[model samples]
Target: MTKPTTTPAEPPYLRIVAAIRRRIADGELLAGDRVPSTRQIAREWGVALATATKALTTLRLEGLVETRPRTGTVVAGTAPPTASPALPSTPSASPVSSASSTGTAPEQELTLERIVRTGMDIADAEGLSALSMRGVAARLGVAAMSLYRYVPGKDDLVLLMADTAYGEESYPADVPEGWRPRVELGARTLWTLYRRHPWLAQLGPISRPLPLPNLMVHGEWVLSALEGHGLDPTRLFDVHVLIYSHSHGLAVHLEREAQAEAATGQSDDEWMDSRAPTLQWLAESGRFPAFTRIVGSLGDGYDLRLDALFEFGLAALLDGLTPIIEGREATSR
Candidate 1:
């Protein structure tokens, strides 16, 4: 049987849709087989719900799946009229029994596309530390060795997972009137995106980027925000890099706290209460009179409001950036 070749235009998610169609045509996804729900596909493919939904909807429209009474959406008994005529075939079309007889045909459906998706979800809910070939295979219900057929190593899997999550949203077609608004909007979007997959902030940028289309789009937008200031490309990119670094650097610790608290079943307040006596002892050391002055102002021991910290840092960054940006504007004029 000949294999299908992907075209330059084929997106990762659409490729997944085509692979699913092939599985249905080849009988691997038999009629009445429960198709994976959108959430599962998102987790499995590391694609966003929008991408997963689009793929499933494409399959549904093509007649590969249909909603049935007393059953959720499933593979239809008959291929939809719109299914590709050249849908690929697998061993399911002609069962093979030999030393090579794997339970499921080596369906191309289990492509790198699927591995990255599942890995992303694991990393998103847990953290990058939680993502592994063994973890992904467990989710796929396959032997750990089986995943080697897809992702090369845990590193490649993680890079792909990061890219897949980054592809979830699009930048605005046009920037707002001012750099302040544009940067604020863009930064907030990234913050929210990282918040959704809190592990994203923890992933280092050292690895070659995953050719993430959306992230590149965001880069273009950020560069445009600095356009009128006439900064060199390096400076423009540096500004963006520094701003995101500030946001994510702080967020990494925040997410770590969240994960730690969840695992240990201890709230921040509770943990701090236990540490209070030590903090008070340090405060009482009259050797540090200036430190005691501030503690007295709060009427309690050092109040560490992380939310306030994030806001204060954000405001300070923007305030500090203004002078530099104004200087560039002055030079440009």
Candidate 2:
């Protein structure tokens, strides 16, 4: 008799992967079609997000799916063979070249700076949530464990990345004459940084802040602008905090919008269009008369310009502060 043949049971994650693979193979999911997100997979399959993540990771390794910033994971045109090589679980002293299976070369210049830079690039292109030690290692063609040698964990790496990003621009040595202008410049600088790195806005809460040195440099700039106005120490710090909050409050939306776009696979305008029926219902309800009237009066040229909003809010905030600062100056005089 022939030897008994036994088929191994598929793991839950592999089962999820197989379902997705079947969709792709059957032409149900075409190339460039977005794969179901981890949340979708977890909900549909009654599995944990980690399992969903692993399934996606396996699919990514097999080149079935690839992540695009603000687009989530999409099916690739060509899928890798079933036996695609996996990333090494152990750290390697020398770098491994993926381009050629046989060649291994020393990473002579692999410093902490290099690791931080790679992390920054990933965080910049994909949101911070997409970043992982293994992801960074793959980008650098290094073992995942090798990253731990330079940075202890993801938290530390993010802090380093934030510091490096903040250090990109600095206040000019020649300061603008007025406090208002100086504060405006400072706010705009911080805003520009947030615009460039949307993920940076999601890093910390206002109550508890990361004690990153370069970010502190920005605080110092804003604080220095308020110093000569004769405000009390507490008042001075409060003003600084307010100015920081003005910029930061608006900036937090940037990453959230990016995440929403990726998760929904819809751009902001597309999302708004989808909600038109609900908005129309609200308008027809007539309860929100003031809101409806203003929205109706708003011209076709009306655009939700964040930069304009920032400037308007900044000006209003500074206008409120101006009287306080000038009143203090007069009171002291």
Candidate 3:
């Protein structure tokens, strides 16, 4: 006697992909029309953001969707791929078994490096809040438990990811001349890393600094520049902290903005525009004349450009420190 075969249930992400695909095929979603964002999909389906992201990725792979700058994801201008009975799945063979059977290393063979890189990729795309061991496993096409073989847990994995991200940049062999230039280089380097990986700024508070080796590399650069400037050890370290905080304090908003967008599905401009009524009310209340006068002077409203602010702040900070650092040099002479 033979038993009947039962097909496996469709994955949540694929189901989302199919539903969106249907809308495109049925002409409900026209070409170049805005599609539901990942956050929207997550809310509508009660799925995790990772699942939502995967659904969109699947749609993109099928040519059903393409992302546009400032427009978010949209239906592709080109026709989507022809429909098939079902989406394809990975080979049934496990990574370990495949390696043994083929006498060659399988590409999917799990490793510490692969796990860390995948985690970093997830944190980079979505904010750190969306990152999870299960999401990393789903992205890698492996069982979640399998990750434990390489990493102890999410806490350790995040440290590894942070260290790897911090290591991406390095100082040149030919160092810049003068303490100010060196300090500036170090500060800008850290800022660049934070900009590249906004979630990095959210790692721990200033009181509990991350003890990552690559992070130490950055600290070493700044500390080396400040050394031998006739300042006491405490003062020199305080100066280093000040420089770090200047960059870090501003960079913290990068992650916050990303989180806000994900939660509200509104861009910075859109969010601010939505609050215009309140601003006008405050202006009319006349309780804050200085604020109203300054804001009303701007014809098109102010655009808060972080990059410009960073540069301006850096210049001002460096200018203020110049006298203090140089004064120490003169006193020592």
Which number leads on TM-score? 3
Compose the digit string of candidate 1's lDDT tens values, residues 1-333: 889887677776788788888887887888777677665676788876557667766777787776542234578785344431221122321222121123343444465656666666556545676677887776655677878877788977777767666666566666478887877766677766676667777766523333666677666676678777766677777777777676677767756766665453334443454455566788797777878787778764456765567667767887878767656446556
Q: Residue 15 CA error for candidate 2 (Å)?
A: 35
lDDT of 1 at 300: 41
TM-score for each prediction?
0.59, 0.69, 0.71
With a 3 Å backbone cut-off (N, CA, C), the pairs that clash in candidate 2 are: none
> Deviation in angstroms for 46 in model 1?
48
Ranking by TM-score: 3, 2, 1
Give the higher-lDDT candidate: 1 or 3. 3
Q: Is candidate 1 or candidate 2 better by lDDT?
A: 2
lDDT-better candidate, 2 vs 3: 3
Name the regions of candidate 3 deviating beyond 4 angstroms.
1-108, 328-333
**Candidates 1 and 2, the one with greater TM-score:** 2
Off by over 4 Å in 2: 1-106, 328-333
Relative to the true structure, candidate 3 reaches a TM of 0.71
